[model samples]
Every structure is written in C-alpha cells, then in structure tokens.
Target: MLSDPKSRFKPTSTAVADKSNILSALKQPYSNAARIAGTMRNAYLTNGSVSKVIDYYQSHPTYNYNIYPVLGNKQYELNDNVRNSYIDIAYYLRDLNIKFFAPIFFKETLIDGVTFWYKYQDKDGVGYMKLPMEWCLIRGTENGVYRYMFDITKLNDETVQSMPEEFQNAYKEYQSNNTSDTNTWYNNKYYYVQENGMAFTFDYNSLVNGGLAISPFASALTDIISLAKAKDNVNIKDNLDATRILQQKLPMDKKDGEMLISAKEAMIYDQTIRGRLPEGVILATTPTELENIPLTNSGTANAFDTVNKGLEQVFFSMGGSSPLFGGSTTSSNIVKEGIKKDANWIYANLFPMLENYYNSEIATVKTKDKLLWNIKFIRQSNFTLHDDIMNLKDQLTLGGSRTDYLAANGFIPAEIISKLTFEQQALDIDSLMVVKPTSNTLSAKDAEIQKRGRPKTDNPSDDTDRLDDEQG
Candidate 1:
C-alpha cells in the first residue's frame, strides 16, 4: 500500500502525519469480521445492494466528482468506526465463497511483502485499483476488465506479530476447500504468483506507484494523546527529516541566461507569429526558448518539468508561492484562503456529505486497520481538496526552494501529457475532504526527527567548467 512507512513515494508532511496518527490509533486490536458485516448491511440495505452502495458513496461530498461517476483520487475523513466497517465487508466477501481475490491474497503470503487490501467502492465507481477513472485512461491492461480480475501481492507483518493460530487454521481450511494453481505475482516471487487460480509476474516498483496522500495529522493528534498518557517509542515531531522526500524529475535548464532564439522562434512560428525569422536570425536572441537540460525528475507521477511549471504558475496564481506552512501569519492567511477555497468548491458544494458518510457510513466506529483504511480511501480519489492543501504545502515550504520546474520549456511525452488535463478541468472533491497531519499538539519522535536539520553534504568534487557548459 502507499501507506508503507518505507514507501518510495514519500508523502508530504501532512500525509506523513496523517498516516502515522492512523497507525497509532489503530494499534489496538479490532474486530475486523464484525465491523465489515455492519457496513455491508447498511451500505447494501439503505443503499440497496452493492450497486446502490456505490451510488451512495458517489453522492457524498468527499467522494463527489465535478464529473459524476468519475471520482478524483484523494482522502475522505474516517473515524475509527468507519474503517472497521470497511474491513468487515472485505472479510465478508472472503467468507462468501465468491472467490475473486484469494489467489492474489494467498500468493502474497509467500512473499509476506504485499500490503494488500481491496476496495469495493471507488470515487468514480467500482474497482479503482484495477480500473481507470475514464475509458480513455486505461493502460497496461484492457479496458472494462477491472471488476473481476486483480493484480495483487500478500502483506506480511514482520515488525508486528504473526497472525494467531486460530486465524491460520481457518485460512488453511479455506485453502483446502479451494485447490488450484492460478498464475499470480508470488507464484515464484521470481515471476508468476499462484494461489487459488489467478497468476501474474510482479513488477513491485511500477505497481506501487502514486495514488493518494495519507494523513499524518492523526499521528500528531495521537502523540498529543499519548503524551498526556506518557509515551516513549512514538515521535510526533514534523519537519523535513525522517527521509520522506518527494523528488520530481522535470525537463528544465538553469535560467542562467536568455533562451535560444531558435527554440523561441520555433514556438513563435508554431502559432503566435507563424512565419520564418526575417534574416537576422540569431538563435540566442529568442527570449522564450528553453535549453535542452534535465530540469527535474518528475515527482508528481505523470508531470514533466514544463507541465509542472505551468501547474506551479496556476497554484501560485491562487495567491500562493507554494504549499502552505501553517506557523506564520502569512501561512495562516494562505491556509485560511486555501481552506475556504477548498470548502467553497463547486464539487465540494455538491457533495457535502462525504466526511459524515465515512464517519457515519464507511468507517463503522472501529479502528481496525485504521492506517490501511485511510490510505485506501485517500488513494481512491483524485479530485479532492486534499490536493489543494498539498499543492499549497508544496509552495510554502521545501517546494518553494525546489529548482525542478525552473528550467522547463514545454516538451512532454504523450503518456504524461494526458494527466495534464487536471489543470482547471474541475475541482476534485477528494482534495477538500482529505486532511494532511498538521496537528502540533503531539509530541512524537517521528515528528521530532523530521524537525532535525540536514547533517550537511561534504562532496569534494568541483565543477569549474559549469559556466562554460551553462551556455549563458
């Protein structure tokens, strides 16, 4: 899951805090089976079966889409009860003999490395992990096949104790009843994974790509709670430490000098001026052209440097320089504006019931798998206010200092180009409901580690030829 503390895609500070809080809160034992059944009963009964349960989810604010049925990836609030309810339903599915994911589930056991769970309802509709939000967004697999098949690995907890004996025996009984070799990701750990039937080779890095930002705010909140109660192992400190950095690669050149007249003319000729250079054409004279330099490695999944810069402009255009940092008066003002804007959104207005739904509906008053639960919900939506806050946080802090987007001049590959449509298309409801961990009331060690400064780099390599190669 993206919630893994060791996630390669380290979430922003807010996300980190949110995840940590959820984990802290969920540390106690929970009744997974019972909780799921309660949600299923309500989701199915009040909403009328699985289909309507999905409908109920779509209509909520946190889940609402500027474009209905097309849910944006982001977080929705979940109290302890809400998460427990979700677990109950998934476990119910496992018990019903309607075997769709057992193969993936069982195979992951061999590796014990998979952080696996299945989401029945997505912001858009069903099967977000496998399905694309839109028909056109489908890649790597065929379209419309997301409902039935799955690409999954098992999750083993080594830091935590292993499953109890009774649970293991029950699982064995189920496996014995269903005996078949299906190709799966863990079939060999080398390639194919097999369990009940389904199988496939595993590509760990690509599969566990970007999705949603989990909240570390809850972690901070928990630290406050733990501190009042006295804690030692947990840390709620927040800063740039703990090594959860989000590095994006973008196509940009250092802005040491003017853009090449040839490249600038290329853009101008492409549309604006639509003609050849008169005759005095000196490539260095063009002001808009960008040099071919690696601006930054993309951090925002499909975003390239040029596109990221454009996004940077739009975000800053929202009266911000980068993502928000809520300590100073300046940060407070921006946070207020961002929060207001997020709350007053068109989509946010339409489906204002999302938070309550998670609280009152999805998360059924239990903390079972709370961390995983939050990560799953956040990952399911894209059009969310959470993105808005995240974008703000990016601008105000380290994001403001990042040099990734400075040198880009608009060249983007076809694949990443599609995702760029997020610019002003519509507000993703998920962003508004999703909150990053920003509570300062906690005294957590993780937060303290984050507050620590860099130990300093002592690189001895000198690049005296930098000026000559800069082409300034």
Candidate 2:
C-alpha cells in the first residue's frame, strides 16, 4: 500500500518468517516441489506479460484448431498457446533457481494441490481418486488440463511395487500393468512403463517479459503465502496466544523460545533491545563489548538516545560526502529507466534511518530478538511504519531508471537487473519436527529426514521420469 502513490507513509517491520520458500518444501517429496512448481508455472503462463512461444500459437488461428485429438481438452484446441504457456513458465522459474520434477507426482506435504484421477471401481470414491487410468494434473503448471488413459493394464513383480500408488493405479487401469513391451525405459531408476514410451513431457520457462515469474505473483503473493502460512498456523496456534506465535514455532531450547536470528529481523530487534542495555554498553561500550549487549542486559532510553544522536551525525556526514541524486532516472538511462516514488523515498526515509540503525544494531549485537536473531529491520526511516510489515527501499536502479526511488523494496520480485557492486551467495531444522522427534539426538534424525530433497521413495525411477521429462 505504501507504493500506491496515494499512500503517504512507508511500510516497515521485522515480522518475516521463512515458513515456506522454494527450496525447503521442494526438498520433500518430488510431488511437493512439482506441485508448487506447477503453481508457479501456471501463474507464469497465465500471466499477461510473458512473451513465450505459446503466445505465438495462441495468437494464430490455424494452429489453434489442431488440439482436440491430442489432449481432448476443448480448451487446448481453442487455447492454441498450450505448449508455449507451459514452457514459458519453465523458463521464467529457471532464473529464480527453481528445480523441476515431472511425470510421477509423489505424495507429500510439499505441494499445495490434490491428487486426482479417473477410471476407478469404487463405491466410496477414495480409492477411485488413487487410480490412475484416468489422471488429472491436480496441480503443477497446467492451468486446467487433465489427461486420461482408458483400459490401462498392470506390470508384474518388482515393477508393480516400485511405482508410486498413484502412477501404478493409472498403469493398471490403462493396460493391466504390462510393460513386457520393450518400451520400458529408466526415468531415473524406477521402471515407468507405457506400451510405447509415451511419457508426459514437461518444460520450464526462464524468462518472461524479462523478469522473475513468481508462483504467488508479487502483487498478490501475500494471498498465496497466507494460504501457506495458514497451514503452519494450523499446527502452531493450538498451544500459544497471539504474542507468542513466533516464539512457539521457533527453537526455544535456547533462552526459552527463540528463532535463530533472521539477519533482517535482528537489525530492528537490536534497536529495541538496545534501550534495555546499560550505560557502559552505550557511551562506554566498544565493539568488543557487542557480545555483552543483549536484552538480558540493556540501557535506558536516555542512553539509547545519546548513542543515536552521535551515530546519526556520523551517517549523515558520510551520506553527504558520498554523492547526490543528480543522475538521469528515465528509461533512457542505462541502469535506471524511470525513477519511482518509492525509490526516491528510500533516499529520503530509509537512508536516514540507517544512521540510527547502525548505532542501534552495533549497540545490541548480542541482544535478543533483532540483535542475536539477524533479522534485518529498517529503523524508522522517513516514515514511521509500524512493526508489522516489511519494507525495503530501492537502492540501485540500473537498466531501469535510478529515478524511481521506491520506499519499499517492492521490486525485489521484479528481479530488478543490476550490476551488483558485490557478488553473492533457511529454516531451522531444529524447530520443524512434528511427527518426528524434537530433542538433541532426535533433532539430528529430523535434520536428515527433513533435510530438503526431492523426496523420492525407495524407487529411483521418480528421478528417471524427471530426467526423461526434462530431456524430452
């Protein structure tokens, strides 16, 4: 809302928790990553700005008419751009470092969609959903495309047991699980058999109109993220009140319930804890004493204010000496095409806040919450945004325009291209053991089990199907 142009103040907070992100969930069952990837891809293809190859087919009249026979979805025939839409999403995600899984959808909590299939003999419909002769993408990149095979068979001995229940059911209903036909090939190690190697082919799109293709979408990402979080709250809210939500969900074995410092959250928390520190930690405390500057021991407001005043003068001196905002901020500018209000606000608000932040951060390096947590927080910059929302100011606007001084790092999603003056480089496994253990030795096991991989079963073919789908 801060970026609404009409909105007057900036947003600020250190409330971020990495409840769900790309790598963490994907490390579970391949299905989890695949499902999330599908959502991301679906959003990418369905988005209006992606300039993928699909747009070509979708734009054409003749090619648009050639689909009903292949997939049976009337929408495919009318949509024309089906293939392009799928792959373009793949391309866009590749840039964000998204990993892809295909063909077999392993069952796990990592994904957000359901398992759907047809062709079943069930009076109760539950087992029917597991049958695969008739299959639905249920989730992943396809927008509404479901594929079904009729009169499926089954394979024999080892192969039958090797398949995921979902895939095996589909195979049995299609052709009685019979892969005696040489068409059987190794997807990874498991045997995914079709009378003729007619496996499903999935693709990735790395770039779109030339920006990051986020799954939840940057604009409405909170909604998707909220759904993901609501799932987490389901497990967490039962024990604690609203105030202790973060603490209860985190690793409290330390000084009680505490999360590993979020470098970002720590930045702001340090500011708060700094007030509780002693006088020596403030005027007399040296960087060497930072370790001793925790909320366990803090200074008074008078001491904190004293330090803030001195620190502010120094930061401003440096900012004043560095440079001014005189460069062109239009699209024609190589680095920054157009300057944004938020970007400009950064120079005015956040930068100034940094002066105070530096002192606050340094003073409470050893403090609780923000200091020891590593949660990066922007102290009150130009605006007094509350302590509930995250806010980042645009510092670099290259190919775009430096002129767009955004108050919030809203463009973090846009993957604003830049010549990073520096080259670079999640979750605490300690806190996430639900069905598993939570103590020391158990925590170790939890680490291994939850270690984050493309959850594959005893069967390796899930890996192989992935390879085939990617290669195809």
Candidate 3:
C-alpha cells in the first residue's frame, strides 16, 4: 500500500506561556532594515526600472535607510560557509539578514545537546520561539553587555509531544527554572549570556541612531531614485513627442469645409482612399503650414545614456559591478581590472568577518586542531584552457622547473612529478639502442621481384609475345 506524502512530513506545535508584556518592556528601537533588504532583493529579481525603484524608496525612506547591514549580512552569508554544517549556519544568516538586517546567532543548551538558534520575530502574537534565525530581536544592551531576547510562545503542544522523553523532561525543567535574579523568570524574559565569541552583529559601521543601524545606501539610493523618475519622465516625454497631429487650413466656403471635415474623418477612421482625398480637398500645402511638430530634443539619446550610467552607479553602490548583473560582457581590460578590484574590496571586508565567525562559533575543537577553519573565498577563474596552457609554457621556458609548472596548474604533486620524470628518463635510456638489419631481410631488388612475380626481361615486348605463344 502507498503512503500519503503529507503524512511523511507532519507539522508539529508546542504550547508555551505568553511573554508579550515582558518582551515589550525591553523593547529595542525598531529598524526597517528588513524592508530595505526586501526591496533590494525584489529590485534585483525583477530588474526594477528606475521609476519603480525610486517610487518604492521614496514612499519608504525610513525603511530604505536600514537595508545596508541586511545587504552586507547577505553577502557574508553567501561568501562564508564553504562547508555544509548540520544546521547550515549560512542559510540561517541569509534568512535573518534578509528579514532583520541585524543577524544574531546564539547557543542554547537543550535536553538532548547544545544547539544553536537564530534570533527571529515570531508571527504568532503569543511570544518568540527557540527557532532558527527566523524572527527575533536584540532586546537591549545594559552596560557593556547585550541581552539576547526571544519569546517561547513558538513552543506548542505538538512540538513538546514529538520530543524524546529525556528532552521533554529537560524542557519542562528548563521552563520552570528561575534565573538568579528574583525579578525575572528564566524562560519568560531576556537574560544575559556570556558572548561565546561566535555571535555576529553585522552593523556595517552604520550610524547607530536610536539603537538602529542606518543603511549606507540610504543617501546614494536617493540620487538613483531621482534618476529613475527622470528616466520615466523622459520616456513619457518621448512618447508625447512621437504623437503628431496634422492640421490643414481649409477655404472659408461651406462646401470645401465640409469636404475637409470628411477627409479628416476618413483619416481618423483609417479609411482614407488609397489614391485620392475627398473631392475638393487638396494634399498640397506650404512648407510652413504643413510642418511636422518636433517632439524629440537634440539630447534625448544622451538622456537615456545618462540613465544607464546612473543605474550602473547604483549597482556599484550596492556592492555589485555592472558586469555581474548582465552588463557588457566584452568589456576592456581596464574595466575588467576595475571589476576585479571591486571584487577584492568586497572580499577584503567580508572574508575576515566570516573567518572570525567561523573560528568563534562553527569551529569545533577537532576541526580547529585539524586546521579546517581556515576559510577561503571561492573566486571565479577568468583564464581559459588555452590561456592556462600558454602561461604554463611561458613559465617553463623561463627556466621554471617541471614540478613548479605542474603544481602551479594543479596537475600533480611535486613528489609525483619527480617519480614520473624518473620513469621518463628510464624510457629515454631504453630507446637509445639501435639494432642492425638481419640477413633474412630482403634487399630492395628482391622485394620488388617478389612483388612483380619475376624480373622483367630487357625486351619486355618479346617476353610478352613469348607468353602469348605459349598460351596459344
């Protein structure tokens, strides 16, 4: 019998006490970082035109200023995490960064083991959950210490029932447990945990106004939005310019006026006769009277070019290059070099942060001992096979050793190259010997006679005649 697909992955919930009042008491400044990040994401996905992007930003300026950290966090998430972890920390960081700009990771000791949880705000009004970095907040900072906050309303009856008996018992004890301070419940309010050095707070050097990190793109995006609106205005103006109305001055006579009106109506209806206008209506007019209205300006083409340039600048400000997002593929070497420089700048800023996070949080004792935490950003190679081969040849010709060339191209280890070189030397030595021809080998004359049956007679025609006589 076949099983139901829905039954295989069941939804579970947990019951937990409400902590809204307690959470509200420790409220941090509200930042619309998530909204800005979401807008950027949408713009990139839809390839939003200047007008659309500007309109969105203008209507939500406060929201727009909060997106930089979110964007930076996402970049970190993408470049960090080369190895797949059990929890996929990169994925969680990406989600949090997109939604909250300020992503936080902290460890929690559960009944089963020590697990990490991402801070996210819960949709359910009851309270937050000990979930992945889905929805949560930085409640507030007291002195130099920061208290990470989350609500337990996300824990439902179904979730508890699914837990192992030991875990369930541990969870119950955890809920009932009280903090050292008598004023707060252990599970109901924000508590200060020692920073394990693994927690990340991606602010991107943003100005802390009212406890919210202001986005770096905020000022630059204003100009981009304006440009977008201007481009739209130019398009609208161009469309208006394309529209031409033909005006003809008719004679004051009622009959001629009537004929002109009829002709105009015919043209309007797209039903004008192929070769003739209405009778008495003349097609001929003075150059001054029948001139086309010029709608396009001399600089109309340049206006569009300017808009394109503005768009490229916007992309650059957002930590991207023109070539990255379907810009010119066959750019000049200087342009390509500029793109590499930009990429390196991003790497320089992002890689260190990722490395620190990995070293503090993700790196286990065993992994550290094995030196597995040394992170490297995956760079896209630009060299083709032919280019690589030419480079290798040039290097080798410049007196570089075979081992160095092979290792540089990642073809083989130095030890293997040495072994192969030794084997090749042996083969060359063996091939140096040459054997003399044996007596059994036929001479050129003997080989030709064998091929042609017998040697031809000096008088070949007479031989042919003799053969013919014998046959006869």
Scored by TM-score, the top model is: 3
lDDT of model 2 at position 271: 60
lDDT of 2 by residue, 1-472 (tens): 0122422111111112243554454354233433444543343344322212123212211100000113333423424454343233323322322111111221111111223332222233211123221122211221212222322223444544544455565455445434454333222222332221121211122112111112212222223344344444443433222221111122223555445656466555656656666543442212121232233212232443443343333223212110122222344342221123223433343233222322222232232221111112222222223221132232342343231222123222123222121122133433453443333333333434654332223244633432222324
Candidate 1 lDDT trough over 10 residues, lowest sum: 130-139
TM-score of each model, in listed order: 0.18, 0.18, 0.38
- Over 4 Å off, model 2: 1-116, 122-127, 130-145, 148-472
Once all C-alphas are superposed, what RMSD does model 3 give against the true structure?
19.0
| lDDT, residue 196, model 3 | 31
How many clashing pairs per prediction, in order? 93, 81, 14
Winner by TM-score between candidate 3 and candidate 2: 3
Per-residue lDDT tens digits for candidate 3, residues 40-126, read: 333334446432333322221111001011224224343332333312433332233321321112101101011123322233211
TM-score sort, best first:
3, 1, 2
Model 3, position 228: C-alpha lDDT score: 57
* Pairwise lDDT winner, candidates 1 and 2: 2
Give the Å shift of residue 127 in candidate 3.
Answer: 24
lDDT per residue for candidate 1 within 1-472, as digits (tens), equals 1233554222111211233443443453121212222222232233212322123223222321110011224535545554344445444322322223323332221121122223333333322122111111101221111111221212133411233232233334334543233431122221121111111112222123321111111112233222222211112221111223222222234576543345545555444332343432223323344454332332333333333344334333323323432123445556556544543442332222222222222233243534332111221123244554356346656544121121111111111223333432444646655654433332344334444222112232364231222234
Error of 2 at 432 (Å): 68
Instruction: Please say which candidate is ahead in lDDT: 2 or 3.
Output: 3
